[model samples]
Target: MSYQRRLHPNLHMETDSQIKQPSGRWGQRTAYTKAPNITDILAELKLGHRVTPVFAHRSYTWELQKMLRARPRPVFDLCYLDGGHSWDVSALGVFLADRLIRPGGLLVLDDLDWSIATSPAFQEGPETLGQFSSDEQQAKPVRLLWEEVLPDLGYSHFAIHPNLGWAIARKRDTKAVVPAD
Candidate 1:
């Protein structure tokens, strides 16, 4: 969620020479970090009268499963997956989101454009079928998988936020049939 950079002073100065003092904060103190912007989503959820936060990491699915299993039912009102950029990880995230989200819940995927629109492996083979053109392909599998999974999950309403490469998917209460006898 955050990144820090460090800078060191040059070591070419002579022992008797006066070294230039660094301005403002020094060393690690000068490092800066930023938090992801989730304020609007949090506010919207509050307005909708929902509480409880279910945080899941795409790369840490096992840990997530363990945590969710230890908790009560309807664990998450909204799930956002932005950890793993790989197809396998993203797909697993979608699957877990389906399991965790209650009827009428919401799910969000972050960095979708970067992951899907630039991965070489995803531009070929099983990852790419009939959905997008060669020039319009994305590197992440979620871009393609969501189309099939959302409807199957009974999410009737979905919207993509302009300019943020973020998408919001809403699960509906429509009865979904299992493909079995």
Candidate 2:
């Protein structure tokens, strides 16, 4: 988002400019690095008031649901899913994002091939061991969602970059099509 802002300094996030962070059960990850607060990072980037910071009191899913309920129509143009690589969280996040994003909107899912079992930061820790099963630890949840879930949902035009470990797909337009007779 900061990079996008750099390219288009006047860009506004509009209604969904709020930054949603994790909380509760989903927030119990062992931090391998001390990262700066997102709001501070955004502020440092001079993202300004256009970017509202809303920390999740529960989970990102809960906050997204609330946003969905408040809005009568799809508004966001893009949604980046990079947190909570587990199926329990990421899957539902994408589902809600489908409703939140407008037709033809971009949905970027990061760490497509990332698995807890292979993560250098988490592989040795109890977080990877006790929190996930052997299969879950080895499985790529983002990749599964990208291949199996998005196609069934209303997304197309995929661009999967394995080297970069990210996938981009556009939400399908829901307009009616006139078939040739």
Candidate 3:
């Protein structure tokens, strides 16, 4: 996170190249203060040893490809796609997860069966869908994708039951099997 320069030809995420894993409790604070910001804290404590955290603030579009192309590293073992509850965004997340998640990795999907099917008459109240626009009203349930679509794409719901419409899917493992002579 140190500094994210939008989507570019490269990830453009370099923190003075000063990445290290300092053992201790990492706190959130400014750079000059005693506490370290989430960016530096994660860089040092989480991935400083041998990994990199590629964060994107914008939508998951073609920029994902550019980010992958720029960094040469092992596939991630876990990925949580928390974009909007629309089919387009969910589909895009699945597509990206397929490429970024390593075989046998876990891909958690949020907001399953969350259509919130209420008539427009009931779509009032500031606490409800009144805050969103027309497009947001079309936010459909994602369980259909997880149940009907993702299976065909080489992913399956984990053994654990999906909690509150949150599906835990694992990528199909493609491990190599050694044949005995």
Candidate number achieving the greatest lDDT relative to the actual structure = 2
Who wins the TM-score comparison?
2
Which ten-residue region of model 1 has the weakest summed lDDT? Answer: 11-20
Candidate 2 structure quality by residue, lDDT tens digits, 1-181: 4553443322222112232222213333222122434554567778766655555554678878898888475477788666567787889989988888888789988788878777655643554367677899889898899999999997985698665567999998777475889
TM-score of every model versus the real structure:
0.53, 0.68, 0.54
Reference-based lDDT, each prediction? 0.52, 0.69, 0.57
lDDT tens digits, residue span 1-181, model 1: 1211221221110111111122322222111112212333345446434543333232356656675687464456787665455566667767776787877788876654555455444444434434556543435455555566677767754888635556788887546565697
* Model 3 error, position 64 (Å): 2.6
Among residues 3 or more apart in sequence or in different chains, the pairs in candidate 2 whose N, CA or C atoms overlap within 3 Å are: none
Q: Candidate 3: what lDDT?
A: 0.57
List candidate 1 stretches off by more than 4 Å. Answer: 1-32, 35-58, 116-138, 174-181
Ranking by TM-score: 2, 3, 1
**Cα misplacement distance, residue 120 of candidate 2 (Å):** 3.4
Alpha-carbon RMSD of each model? 15.0, 6.8, 12.8
Clashing residue pairs in candidate 3, if any? none
For model 1, state the Cα shift of residue 4 in Å: 23
